[model samples]
Target chain A: DVKVTQSSRYLVKRTGEKVFLECVQDMDHENMFWYRQDPGLGLRLIYFSYDVKMKEKGDIPEGYSVSREKKERFSLILESASTNQTSMYLCASTVAGQGAWTPLHFGNGTRLTVT
Target chain B: DQQVKQNSPSLSVQEGRISILNCDYTNSMFDYFLWYKKYPAEGPTFLISISSIKDKNEDGRFTVFLNKSAKHLSLHIVPSQPGDSAVYFCAARGLNAGNMLTFGGGTRLMVKP
Candidate 1:
């Protein structure tokens, strides 16, 4: 079984503070993703890394960035956390497999609250 | 533009009844579709998937039906259990798109005992 673990289940930060969310996967998947879930908005991609040191901006990457220094770890960084940035963040990994189809294994998610 | 759409925001079903969740996509290039279940405070978990070539795929009590012509798909859960209550998200991936997925807004399923 594949396991994806997030650094925190809940977090609280003041406005303009820097925040980091960490994720680690045991499957050594090549693709890692960060997403934020909001009511009525679904899960919007924030950033994704296809390989170590390679990152791409997803649909909503503003005010957020990601790091993939190693194959097993991915981190999401908020430059300046704002109240609007409060959300449930999810990390997922997908193994490179046949035919462009790979099931994403996801972590439990971190709910961040900015005050 | 929202490529994937789930029109219904929520659905309620009696225990042991069938629960159907629908999803539509505007992108015709998507060849892979998936269903994920998410509980509060948890990330979405992969449930089942179907390829564009096949119209139907089933696993246990979950069945996914796809209509290529309409660019739509549906998930049917037989004998819905209370544990099935959660937000269900539909995701799609285009050919050669790697593992990136476009997801629907999701529909909350509530099962009554």
Candidate 2:
């Protein structure tokens, strides 16, 4: 029973404002990911962290960044929120390995609304 | 370009009937496939998975079937229940690539009594 928790389930922000979304996992998985889900677009990866302080850009990383200061916590930062940025964000974690077939444990997700 | 595609936007089925959700992928490199179920306002939960080495994987009432040559896969739920009503997403990952996954747009399943 792995638990992945997101800091906020819902959030509202004005345009041009910076926003932070946090995620924490109890399983101590080495790989954490941030994804934005939009209607018709499915889940597109924004950023991922393989280890503390190590981050990689995913398919849709523009206008977004991530932080992994600790093993258990990963944060997604919206540099400047815009109306188009409004969407559901998901965080997931999994163990580190080559032959690992572990399924990602996901948080409930944060729905952010930018007005 | 959409690498993975779930053609059906929605499907309706009656309780005690079988519900089939189909998904297709364009990438031949994809070696692993997965199915996830998501309720409204909740993140997608892992349902079942199948590797390229095998064509079918079953778990409880859910079964995943993969067709490598056609680059297609499907999820079948037997005796579908109301609780099975949700959005289902099909995902794929390449063997050599990192664990990053490419997901289909998803199909919504509605089970009615």
Candidate 3:
């Protein structure tokens, strides 16, 4: 089985604070993604990394950025957190290509509260 | 524009009944569709998927039906159990989208015992 681990389950930060959410996948998948879940909005992609040191913006990536310094680890960074950024963040990884034929293994998720 | 849509925000069904969740997409380029189940605090987990080549795919109590012309798909869960209560998200993948998946707003399904 593939395992994806997020560093934090819950976090609270004041406005304008820098926040970092970490994720690690044991499967060594080449693709990693960051998504935020909000009621009535479902899950929206923040950023995705296809390889180490390569990143692409998703539908909503204005306030967030990502890092993929290593194959197993992907980090989501909020350069300056805002209340609007408070939401459940999810990290997922999958093998390259194959699309829906390949399932994305996800972490439990990190609930960030920006106050 | 919202490419994928789950218009129904919630659904309730009694145990042993069939629960149906619907999803629609506007992008005709999408050839693959998937359903994911998520609990309150957990991330969405892959449920079932159907390719455009097939109209229906079944696994156990879960079956997915796709209509290419309508650009719609439905997931049916028979003998619904309480454990099946969760938010169900519909996702679609276009050939050009690579690993990126377009997700719908999601529908919350509650099963009562």
Candidate 4:
């Protein structure tokens, strides 16, 4: 079975503090994604990496950034955490050419709360 | 603008009954649609999917029906069970959208005995 591991299951950070959320996938999928899930707004993509060292901003990328220096690891960075940034973060990965047809494998998710 | 929408926030059904979750999209360019099921503390898992070219797809107890003209889709679960209680999200992708998917707000389903 494919497993996507998140570094933290729950995290609390003070306002204006820098925060990092880490994810690693054992499936060796070429596509990795970071999304924030919120009530009534659903899961909004923050950033995604098609390959190592390459990243693209998604719809809600204003408050977040991401890094994918290694193929299996993708990291989401919050330069200055704020109260509004509190939400459940999810990490997902899928194969390359078949991304459209392939279902994404996701981690258990990290719940971040910024005070 | 919200491209995908799941109007109902919650639904309740009895075990052995049918549960239907609806989803709608405004983007005419979206050709691929998928449904994902999520439980508390876990990530969303793929449930079923139907392409614009096809109207319906079924897997086990789950079935997805798509209506391209109306930009509407629905997920149907037959003989719903207690374990089927979860949040269901509807996602859509355009032809060139790659792996990026636009998701709906989600519908929470509770199956009671």
Candidate 5:
């Protein structure tokens, strides 16, 4: 089974504070993604990395940024955390692109509460 | 504009009954569709998928049907179980979308015993 691990399960941060959410995948999948889930909005992609040091912006990527310095680890950075940025953050990994019929394997998720 | 949409916000069904979840999309570029199930405090997990070429796919008690012309899809779960109660999200991906998937708002399904 593929395992995706997130460093934090629940985090509380003050406004303007810097927050870092870390994720690591045991399988050497070529793709990693970060997404945020709200009550009715479902899961929206924040950022994804196809390779180390390579990142692409997803639909909602304004307040968030990501890093992939190593193949197995991907980090999501909030330069200045805000109230609206508080949401359940999820990390996922796949062996290849969706076109290749690979479903994303996801972590338990980190619930961020920015106050 | 929302590319994918799930009209129903919630659905309730009794055990041994059938649960049907619907999804619609506006983008013609999408060539693939998927359904994911998510529980509270947990990330969404892939459920079932159907390619544009095929209209229907079945696995156990779960079956997914697609109507390409209508740009719609539906998931049918027969003899619903309480464990199946969760949020169901419908997702789509196109050839031009690369590795990303666009998801609908999702519908919460409750299966009662």
Candidate 6:
């Protein structure tokens, strides 16, 4: 089974602090994504990387940046954590062209709280 | 603007009964639709999906129905069990959307025995 792992299951950060969320996939999938699940808002994409060193912004990417220097790893960075930034973060991976038809394999998710 | 929407915030059903969850989308660009189930503290998992070309797809007790003209879809679970209790999210993607799937607000389904 494809496994997408997130570095943290729970995290607490202070406002204005820099935060990094890490994700790693073992299936060697070419597409990786970061999304935040908020109440009433659903899962909104933050960023996605289709290849090493390549990144693209999604629906909600204002307070976030991502890095994919390594194919198996994708990192989401919060420039400065804010109270509103606290949310459940999910990482997912899928084979490139099969995205539209195939379902994404997702990690357990990281719950972050900013105070 | 929310492209995909699940108007029901929650639904309750009894075990062995039919549980129907609904979803609607405003964008005609959406060509494929999917249902995802999520438990607390866990990421959502793909439940069932239906392509625009077809109106229905079934897998075991789960079935998905899509109406292209109305831009609406529904998931049906027959013989619903307590294990089926979770938040059901409606998601969609355009043909060329890549790996991005737009998700709805989600409907929490509780199956009581």
Clashes of each: 0, 0, 0, 0, 0, 0
Which sections of candidate 5 miss by over 4 Å? none
**Which residues of candidate 3, in runs, are more than 4 Å off?**
A98-100
Residue pairs clashing in model 2 are: none
Who is ahead in TM-score, 2 or 3?
2
- Candidate 2, B28-97: lDDT as tens digits: 8888899989999888999999998899999999999998889889999998999999999999887775
| Least well predicted 10-residue stretch by lDDT in candidate 3 chain B | B93-102
For all candidates, state DockQ relative to the true structure: 0.69, 0.70, 0.68, 0.67, 0.66, 0.70
TM-score of 5: 0.97
Candidate 1 lDDT over B1-113, as tens digits, reads 89999999999999999999999999999989999999987779999999999999999999999999999999999989999999999999988888889999999999999
* DockQ of candidate 1 compared with the true complex: 0.69
Error of 5 at B102 (Å): 0.8
Give a tens-digit lDDT track for model 6, residues A5-98: 9999999999999999999999999999999998888899999989999999999999999999999999999999999998999999988984
Residue A42 in candidate 6, Cα distance off native in Å: 1.0
Collision pairs in model 5: none
Q: lDDT at B75 for candidate 5?
A: 99
lDDT by residue (B11-93, candidate 3, tens digit) is 99999999999999999888789999998878789999888899999999999999999989999999899999999999998
| Higher-scoring candidate on DockQ, 2 or 3 | 2
lDDT per residue as tens, model 2, A12-97: 99999999999999988999999988877789889998899999999999999999999999999999999999999999999886
Worst lDDT 10-window in candidate 5 chain A: A95-104
True contacts kept of 5: 0.63
Give the Å error, residue B60, model 2.
Answer: 1.7
Give candidate 4's root-mean-square deviation (CA, Å). Answer: 1.0
DockQ of structure 2: 0.70
lDDT of 1 by residue, A1-115 (tens): 9999999999999999999999999987999999998887788999999889999999999999999999999999999999999999999999875475879989999999999
Docking class of 1: medium
Chain A TM-score by candidate, in order: 0.97, 0.97, 0.97, 0.96, 0.97, 0.96
TM per candidate comes to: 0.97, 0.98, 0.97, 0.98, 0.97, 0.98
